[model samples]
Target: MILEHRTYTFKPGTVDKWMKKYEAEGLPIQKRHLNRFVGLYVSEIGVLHTTVLMWAYDSLADREARRQAMYADPDWQSFIAEIWALDAILQQDVMIMNPAPYSPPV
Candidate 1:
């Protein structure tokens, strides 16, 4: 399986706002189009104001297809537009990882 890890860093004190908005609006659309939802988290120690989102997919192609569908969906577009309007995000990073043989199933 492949896991997509997304990390977003926002300005100070904006994480909660972003999370709330995502939970209320974005999560529903993502839940419908995306693969397995691994977890959502906020950094508490180093690099404060960071949020991490992880999703599991059967393969890279599956991930790409699902993401493309999500991007095409109007609800997702609206959610992202709201997020961008907030202007709180500072940086974002994404990684697709292969789990070790010994790792537990995602």
Candidate 2:
């Protein structure tokens, strides 16, 4: 299994707004398209304005396909457009990971 880890850093004080918007709109759209939704979290101690999202997929190809479909959705497109207009995001980091043999199933 492969895990997709996405971390987004928003401008100061804007993370809450972004999270609310995502929960109300983006989450639903992603839930429909993604196969294994892991979780979403915010950093409390280290990175104040950052949010982390985790997703599991059977393979890289599966991740790509699912993400492609989600991107093609009009609702998702519109939601992202609004996010971009907000200009809240400062940076984004994405990583594809593999669990260690001893790691528990995600």
Candidate 3:
């Protein structure tokens, strides 16, 4: 599986608002097109006022396709624009990583 991870840092004192907006709008849209949300989170440590959204896909191609579709969707564009104007600053990243190897019980 491919993991797409992003973290958003909300301005001080705006975490609640950010989470509310995400729950009401962002999550639904993501569920519609992505349908593969492993988890979404609000950090309680390190970057206390930040959020993380993780999604899993079958492969890199699948991830690209989902991203392209989300970008082309009008709802996503506007939703992002609204958040980009406030509650977020200098905190966004995407990383694709491979899972670490593990041995079965001997």
Candidate 4:
């Protein structure tokens, strides 16, 4: 199993606005194509105006296929357009992780 961790850094003071747009337009599309939804988070201390998403997959190929499908979906494309209109995102970081031996299984 593998996990995909994504951290999105948004322009300062626009987190709430962007998050609202994502929740309304993006979450449903993600739910349809993404494999496992772990959690969504916002930074409060160290990195302000940042959002994080975590997802689990059977393998890297599975992750790639799912994401590709999502990107091709019309709904997802529109959501991307909406986000681009907001122009709030500054940077995005993605990390592919494997569970440590000592880590408990979900």
For residues 28-95, write the lDDT of model 2, one tens digit per residue.
99999997889999999987899999999999999999999999999999999999999999999999
Top-lDDT candidate index: 1
Evaluate model 4: give its lDDT: 0.90
Tell me which of candidates 1 and 3 scores higher on lDDT: 1
How do these models rank on lDDT, best leading?
Answer: 1, 2, 4, 3
Candidate 3 regions exceeding 4 Å error are: 101-106
Pitting candidate 1 against candidate 4, the one with the higher lDDT is 1
What C-alpha lDDT do the candidate models reach, one value each? 0.96, 0.94, 0.78, 0.90
**Model 3 alpha-carbon miss at residue 80, Å:** 1.1
Residues 23-106 of candidate 1: C-alpha lDDT, one tens digit per residue = 999999999999999999999899899999999999999999999999999999999999999999999999999999999998
Backbone clashes in model 1, listed as residue pairs: none
Q: CA shift at 25, candidate 2, in angstroms?
A: 0.3
Q: Candidate 4, clashing residue pairs?
A: none
Q: What is the TM-score of each candidate against the true structure?
A: 0.98, 0.96, 0.84, 0.94
lDDT (10s digit) by residue, model 3, range 8-92: 7767888887788889998888888884788888888786878888888878988888878988999999999998877456567
Summing lDDT over every window of 10 consecutive residues in candidate 3, give the lowest-scoring window.
97-106
Query: What C-alpha lDDT, on a 0 to 100 scale, does residue 10 get in candidate 3?
Result: 66
- Show the lowest summed lDDT stretch of 10 residues, model 4: 97-106
Clashing pairs for model 2 are none
Best by TM-score: 1
